[model samples]
Each structure stands twice: as C-alpha cells, then as structure tokens.
Target: MAAAAHDPAGAYDLLVIGGGINGTGIARDAAGRGLRVLLCERGDLAEFTSSSSTKLIHGGLRYLEYYEFRLVREALAERERLLRLAPHIIWPLRFVLPHDEGLRPAWMLRVGLFLYDHLARLRTLPGSRMVRLRTSPVGAPLQARLTRGFLYSDCWVEDSRLVVLNAMDAQARGAEIRTRTGVEAARRQGEGWIATLRDGASGRSETVRATAVVNAAGPWVSETLGGTLGIDSRAAVRLIKGSHIVVPRLYEGEQAYILQQPDTRIIFAIPYERDFTLIGTTDVPYEAEPGPVAISPEETRYLCDCINRSFARRIGPEDVVWSYSGVRPLYDDAAANASAVTRDYVLDVAEADGTRPALSVFGGKITTYRRLAEHAIEKLKPYFPGLAPAWTGDAPLPGGAMPGADFDAFLAALRREAPFLPDETARRLARAYGTNAREILRGARSLADLGEAFDGGLTGAEVDYLVRHEWARTPDDILWRRSKLGLRTGPDSAARLAAHLTRGRAEAA
Candidate 1:
C-alpha cells in the first residue's frame, strides 16, 4: 500500500529519495533484506525519466562503439533474470537493424552482434542472425536498397509499471513508499540523519530520521545533493534530453526497426500500444531547467527523417499523435558528443562518520536496475553489518509469480477461466496484472460486473483497484502512467473517470 506521510515507528534504517526504477529497485531490494526502509517520491513513481525510455531492455547495441563491455555484459546477463521476474510486463522483442550502405560495415556489425550474443549466458532470449530484408515481411516496410539486416533479440518493458511493481514489492516487504513527498532537507544529527519531508498534497512538512540516505533522484541528483542534503557530491550529471513520437502503426507485424542516422546516432521505430507505432529518442544536450520536457520541432523532424531513410512509408511531425521527452542524468565523463556520455552509473558516497551514510546514484539504464540495487545495498554493508545477502535475481515481483514464468500458458489459462471477458480486455489485464488479474475479475460473472465502462477497457473495478493498491491519485497517473489508455480514449472518457473518482472520494469522506 502507498503509505501516507505518517511513520508511527519513527526512525528508519534507510531513507530512499526518488521513485524511479533505480530508487524503487533499491527500496525493494533493501526492504527484502530486512531493513526499515522509507521511500519518498516528489511525484508519482516514474513521472519522468524512468517512464520515458525507448522501453527496450537490451545490452545497448550502439554502446559497443564506446567500449562499454562491462556494462553491456552485466545488462546482457540480467535480461533473462528480469524476464523471469516480471514476465507479464516484459517480453522478448526482435529488432531488425538494416545495413544503411555507408554506415558501419557488415563485418563490424557482425562483430558487435557476436560480442552481444556472447557477452553473457543468454539463457532465455535467442541469439542474433542475419536476415534478408528484400524477401521477408520485415523488409516490406523498409526501403528496397536495405536488402540485408541483422535481427537480434531484446526485451520490451512497460517501463512505468516496472517502477510501480518495484514500489509495490517494496511496500509488501514492509518498506513505506510515500509518494508526492519530498525530502526538503536532511542533516546528520548525532549518529543518524534527520530529514524534513514535505508532502505535496497537504503542504505539510514532517520530521523523520534515518540511519542512512540514498539519493537516487534521477534528474535532481546534483540539486538534491547541494540544495537538500547540503553535501557536495563532486559528481556531475550530463543531461541529455531524449524525445519520442507516436503515430499510427507504420507497418503491420510485431517486428521493430533500428534505423541508423548519418550523424552516427540511432533511433527506433517500434510497435506501440496496439494501434500506434512508437518512434524516437533523440539525444540532444539539455540546457534548460530539468523537469518535464517536450519533443522539440527539430527532434520530431529528426526522428521522422531518421526512420524515413529506411521505411518506405514516410512520416512527419504532423503525423505525430503523441510525443514525450525525458532528460537522462548521465555521470559526466566529458565526452565531446551528447550521445557519447556513458550510460553506466557512478555512486558517490559521503559519510563523515560511520553511522550516517549518504549515497547518491548517478546514471543507469532500466535493464540494469536490479543489479544496481544489489550493488547499492552491498555498498552500504559497512553501515549495516546485519544486512541480508542479495536475493532479487531469482525472486518474482508481485503478480509475476506464475509457474514457469510462461506468460503465454498463463494467458491461455486466464482466457479459459474468464470466458466472458473480451479478448483484447483479457489480454490487456493479463499483461498488466499477470496472475493477479483474476482477483480483479473475481465474483463478477459477466462484463456488467466490471462496473461502468471507460475507454480502453478501463472499468470502475480497475480504477478502485488502482486506487486501493497502486497509489494512483490523479487522472494522468492512471490514464498515462498506470495505463496508456489516454492514447485512444478521448477527453470525454477522461472527464467521466475524473468525476467517478471525485464522487468516490466524496463518499469516502
């Protein structure tokens, strides 16, 4: 459950700021290892960076250029572990990277693929292969000149849900996940740190204490360190704004494309939501204040043109139906190019005394979050002599505890059990909730039992479930983050949902 800004037992062992993938992952891992943990987020979980990813859980194919072998190897090893942990929200996706004539040579591409394939023991995802783009259906959408391509395996994740699932698991393990709350200031008092948490909803500040503080604040790492914690991290962040655009499904089929740009950068054109194609992620140096960002006209045009070079069907900024942007807080290694900044994480520790420790997380991608969490906890081992050994690798996150981690088999059985549900609705619920989907549909014999219908299969029952279990408050939390129904559902349905939630709250009051 999402806890209120009230902690009756007083002090905690760990106080985690930022509710992104890294923060929640650390919270889940630390709490499971028997720590009194309290995770406070300034907004809803993944309201920024974590939610705004290309949503690929892969050893970044392009990172090979930068010689990020260790990062790639660690990420490559984690794919199957995460796939097993949350099969509902994560699944294998095949990417077709076509040879663009003047770009990297075929042999170089093969070498990179070979390294990616053997980087780690890939137990679940298949290895890479060369494909004939001219004859295959995957080629139909591409330009004819792109005759040869490399087909490789990666996993796609519901990024926001992954954050939420981690927060949920953390909560289940006795970690207090307090959302819409920010640690205004923290100071080391005696042997521990005393923190003032400001709740956004109530405009109230409460005093809390923790033996250690973990700053996983993604974009606000520096700001949080200097402004809130009054500690100089000495580590800097390179803010690279990444933007994506969604349009009508560009091509038919489940396969996605990784288009190469003349600038040596790459963009992905993936199938998104059922009816739309997701394209994007431009790496631009961000100079402005770091908060919510939008896709600039240049970025939109850049994305369209990148994919246009390969795809036969052309697209433009006007074709964009939805666009989102997030700024990556990469640890600055001072690379000349914005895209060349490392995706690896750097941990800066500040502990004047042995008891009160402040650890700030710098840069990391989603695929390595679990490993990052394990390592973060291990870093604090000196502070907590009794900290339990790491265990997230083999464990399952909440609803993903289905036998064998076989999503297809579990989905088929769900269809048989809930015969009355629409095929699309059933599949959506199964993907979102996994085995726990049945509980939401339990006691309801027919579609009518789902309560008032909203767009994109959202029902009153699901809304109540989200409010009760998922820490959802505003419409945007449910519409955009908890579910992407906002893509298809119009304003009318959103208004109705707003009213329903308001009325429900009033009755409870």
Candidate 2:
C-alpha cells in the first residue's frame, strides 16, 4: 500500500512546484493526459492566497469599467462551466448592486448591468434586472435612501475545497501529491531538470528528476525563479493585499450584496456558513513578505466602513469575529492604482533549442484556473507530444457527479440513506464529499459506530478517511481547507484532535 502511494521510479514527466489552484489544476490536466506528474507544496493546499478570495465565481463587473471585455467574457463563460462541473461546491448566487446615487450614476449602473448580462449567454442562472428597494426583499436590511438597485447572477464557490478536489482528481489519475515538501532548488540536467525537495516535518532531503517543470508558486513565483532555479525571470508580479472579515449574520436572506464604495471599488457581503455574513475585500498596496498575512486594523475599519455605507445597521471593528488577508500576486501591468492592476495570468516558458522547459505561471483568479491549465499545457505541447487533449471542461470533479448534477436532489438521497445521522450532518457530508460521502460512512450503522466525536460533527472515522485518502497530515488541513469548521469550532479544536491523530498514525505505522 505504501509503495503504491508514491512514485517508486523517483522520476516523472512533469514536476509541478506549488499546490495552489493553478499548479493542482495543471497537474490534474496533465495527469489526465497520461503524463506522469509530481506536485510538491511547501504547505497544505490552498493554505494561502488560493483560500483567501472573495469566494465568487463571477466575471468582474468592475473590470468592465476598465474595458477588460475579454477577461469578463472568458470568466463569465468559465463561471457557467464550473457550475456544471462542480455542482456540489459551486452554486448560483444573486448579487444586489444597490444604486448609490452619490457614486456611480443610475444610468451608468444600468448600462454596466446591461453589458454584464449580455456578455455571456447564461443558461443556469437568471439575467440582470433593476429592482425597487422599497418593495424588494433584498433592500429590507439596507438604508431607506438606497431605494434602487440591480440584481445580477453569479456563483459562489468553496474556494479551498475546489483546490483539494482538483488535487484529489489528479492523484486518482496517477499523479503524486506531496504536501509539506518544498523544492529547494532545481537545475538543468541534459534533457530534463533535477530538483531537491526537503520534507518540512522530517527535515530530510531527496532529489527528483523530471522532463519538465512548472512554477505556480503564487506569491513566491518570482522568488522561486531567482532563488531556487537561479534564473532571473522577466515576469513581474504586483503584490496587492486583499482582506476579509466575518461578522454575525448581517441580514436574513440567502442573497449577497455588492456594495459600491466611494473610491469606486466594490465589496461583497455574502451569506457564509449559515451563521455568519462574510464581508470583505480591501485592495491595498502590499510590500512585505507574502505568507501569514492577516487583516490589519486599518483594513478591518475600511471594510466595516464600506459595509456601513451600504447597510442600515452600523458595525465597528468589535463586530468582527474572524478575519483573513492574502497578497494577490498580480501580473504587473504598470497600472497606477493597485486595484486597477490586471487579474489576468501570464505563462512564461524558459528553454533553449535543446534545453528542458521550465514553465512559470503568474497572476490568476480562481474562476479561470482550469482554462489557464489548458493553456499552460498547450504551450508545453512540443515537449509532451503524446499528451491527451483537454478533458476537464465537461468532466465532473471528484465527488461532483451527482444525478443530473443536481445538488439538492443528491442531498435528499444522502439523508434518506443515512437516517441515523442528523439532517445537518448529512447535508455537511453531502456538500463536502458529495458522491464520496458513502465511502466515509461505509460500515457505520450509527453514530457510535463512527468512533469518537469531536466538538462539532467531525468524528474519528472522518478524520481517518481524510488522512488516508486526502494528504491531510495536520489538523489544519482537515479544519481549514477540507472544511471551514475552523471558523465555528473552538481555537483549541485543532489542538484537541492532535492526540487522536498521533495515536492513529502510530498504530498505522
């Protein structure tokens, strides 16, 4: 079993550095194409910027003001595609863009919505339409003066879960996913490149060789290029910090709000975890190190102020329960304003006539990761001649293949099958594991059969499944990425699971 879990040959066709969305997406695509791929991440998947997003799968409506029609169109199309591909984690959302008479004019807002509606022909979701706040339920929580607004369709995603699902699919297709393994350095060796990987936990090093390499290290892209590969890359990335705050339930609706700030930037207040309203996203110029970013007091105030301007209820920094920050490694386009910088991605390939190719990816949002992977693999087609055609667009991600891709129907069936479990517990499992929920519940007829129970719905059986199937070594991997129960559980919840996991690992070893 151990031998089958790793690459015995110690070599691969592609060595992908970084386990974020793009790297995992590329590894999944390449492995599906019959390429032997190895992906190594210095930390847990989506532990950084990939998990710290606005959690929307929409075409940037604000980007239209900057005339980024191409990006908008592509993203809008991808949004619809993802809704079908991963119905378990991606769902349609209605965003209310309140007409702030002080800022963008009513006529201008109408025109932008018109363009946004017509950009890509939406099939699963409804188009945009103007609404009167006086009668609309969406405006019940807003100020009286905000009497007019426009409602449009977008999608919400389980951001970190999306990354893990891609990695799981990649591993299922014969790709090696090594978490907590950092690639210290790599150099050209004849027709391929050799890399040195250091295990974070064991403090051990091993050498790996691959025919090609992909650097999708997010914020560490430039640093990885210069420090590890010894190549001075021309590709520049602008580090812009984005932060979000989670507060108590702001309103009583499932719909989200897109607040237009006085600075012309936008903030989203979405229904999160059924108990909290997630508000956020301040775009600030960042110049510090990338990892371990946290929302500053100023950023919290800024976000609170943005919300206060739109909603009737007032909130201060004290209202914030939890906050997170991430530095977006955007491709430098020389834009004066940090918010004006392009979110588009750039793929740079370094290779001579006979040298091995090292592909570096920079600056992309979550919505277009799959398309970016397709493009990246196509660029390296000359080296991988036997690669398969793109197959991820129509294919369902792991555990997403519900009947007709209908999540509600699948949830109903899951509840009926697991009558012993609570409705909320069944729903959580269905949402997180989808069709794979049965695998975790196998041979368990009752709650006691599932073994020990944590404070929340988490159980010993689920933890064992995560460690055995997913590359979950630490409790954070299960709490934060695989699930967001970290937000609701106690601060010591992860620590409390430590002894259980340690015992389990020792018994298995």
Question: Tens digits of per-residue lDDT for model 1 on 48-121?
Answer: 99999999888898999999999999988888789899999999999999988998899999999999998877
> How far off is residue 107 in model 2, in Å?
1.6
Q: Indicate which candidate wins on lDDT.
A: 1
TM-score of each: 0.98, 0.98
Score candidate 2 by TM-score against the native.
Answer: 0.98
Give the backbone clash total of model 2: 0
Question: Which predicted model would earn the best TM-score?
Answer: 1
lDDT of 2 by residue, 1-509 (tens): 13225456588989999999999999999999988899999999888999999899989999998999988998999999999989989999999999998899999989998898898876568988999998989999999989999999999999988998999999889888888999999998877889999999899999989999999999999998888887777889989999999999999989999999888799999999888999979999989877888988999999999998879999999999888888899999999999899999999998856568989998989999999999999998889877789999998999999878899999998888889998888989888888988999998889998888876699889988888887787788888788888876775666778878899889988
**lDDT, model 2:** 0.90
Off by over 4 Å in 1: 1-9
Clashes of each: 0, 0
